[model samples]
Target: MLTGQKRKFAIALMSGSTQAAAAIKAGYSEKSARSKGSQLAKDPDVIAYMHKTRGVEESANPEVTKQKVEPEKMPVVNTLTGDFDDPLDFLKSIMNDRSEETDVRKDAAKAMLPYVHAKKGEGGKKDAKLGAAKAAHSKFSGMAPPKLVVNNKG
Candidate 1:
């Protein structure tokens, strides 16, 4: 006579419906047998042994051990004048080219003007504001502005 524990163990070892049904007939309660089978399914050693015995490949379940991936870092920028360099001489040299279009120079100057003005503390006299403005202005002064064009067309 198979004891309840041995019947449960036998049910867990058997696979498939026919084998499991046969084990159940031999005295294991279907519910207890199925529960034990589920427990055995979760056993790492049993799973590994089953893999070797059945010649089955073991695969990791992504859901079982997922971790949150960190986001990529953004490039840092200098706060002063919103310019990367302390002295923007390089920008000035590029803008000062005589062969460059007048409009292109004007646009570049216009874009850089705001950063310069902001850095010079023109709008606010606060020490921090003044410091930032001075830095930006000094950087701006390094860049030579393109000549102005007179357009008489209305």
Candidate 2:
């Protein structure tokens, strides 16, 4: 019953993509994909097809029928100790303490150096055309402009 991008979206959803991601992969505009995907997922036909394809029973909540997986744990920093007030402080202590390994201390210092050093006019307005230039630079490490050439022969 599904056709075009709707079919693509349904297949993608059955393969484990989120509704929003499936919509985008189905050629929907990113700006409207979230809403469009949600709308499509609510269709009875789509839900039925998804259930049949996945061998899941039709239910009041098709969403709950899908497999359940645990989300990854995010790293947590404990700030209760009076040893360091913030992450920056911890890094600063490591950077300045000579007792730490030279490589570890150097890494800590490198991390802290950015806050201590400020570039000229860093917060000022940016040039709109700089985006393309930046992308070009990133494509090649140590990239440089080619030399201009002019020749006259008589």
Candidate 3:
């Protein structure tokens, strides 16, 4: 029943072409390809022929679809295994590394600077005040509770 451009259109559609592309390929006018392709796809004869061809293709025992299995967790490879004895050793390594960018090496150098040289006015009264403030905070480590009393009558 399906023999002409309709048949060609259905064949093209089954081959993974869009409705518009299939319509254009089956000798339909390019201007109306978009609309005509949609119309031809809905034709009863075209549907029947496509269904018959699909059944025949399946009968040939080909793998229609395969489910891909993925691993739950990927293996992680650790590069560093106790390479540096001290934390400063790691910082120094990063600072001296030529492969790293200039800014990155400079940041590592800046981080290590405080550890090497102590500032003149480092120890002050602020440290003792901070200790007293921390003790006061421990006196009230309990978190804020929900307000239960509702004062409606003013």
The stretch of ten residues in a row with the least summed lDDT in candidate 1 is 66-75
lDDT computed for candidate 3 = 0.71
| Cα lDDT for residue 9, candidate 2 | 83
> How high is the lDDT of residue 136 in model 3?
88
The top-ranked prediction according to TM-score is: 2
Q: Give the TM-score of candidate 2.
A: 0.39
- In candidate 1, what are the lDDT values of residues 1-154, reduced to their tens digit? 2244443343335333343453465466787766655554455654443343333355587442222212222123222244445435545644675544355556667766766667544454587787787777854476667999999998
Q: Per-model C-alpha lDDT, please?
A: 0.48, 0.70, 0.71
Report backbone clashes per prediction: 4, 0, 0
TM-scores, all models, native as reference: 0.24, 0.39, 0.36
- Arranged by lDDT, best first: 3, 2, 1
Q: Kindly report which residue stretches of model 2 are placed more than 4 angstroms away from their true locations once superposed.
A: 60-64, 68-154
Local error of candidate 3 at residue 87 (angstroms): 92
Task: Name the candidate, 2 or 3, with the larger lDDT value.
Answer: 3
Q: What lDDT tens digits, residue by residue, belong to model 2 across residues 1-154?
A: 4656776787778677899999999899999999999999898767765554455665678466775322222123333336766778989877777544456678898888778897655663454347556666664577468999888774
| Candidate 3 segments exceeding 4 Å error | 56-154
Which residue pairs come into collision in candidate 1? 119-132, 119-133, 120-133, 121-133
Ranking of all candidate structures by their TM-score, best first = 2, 3, 1
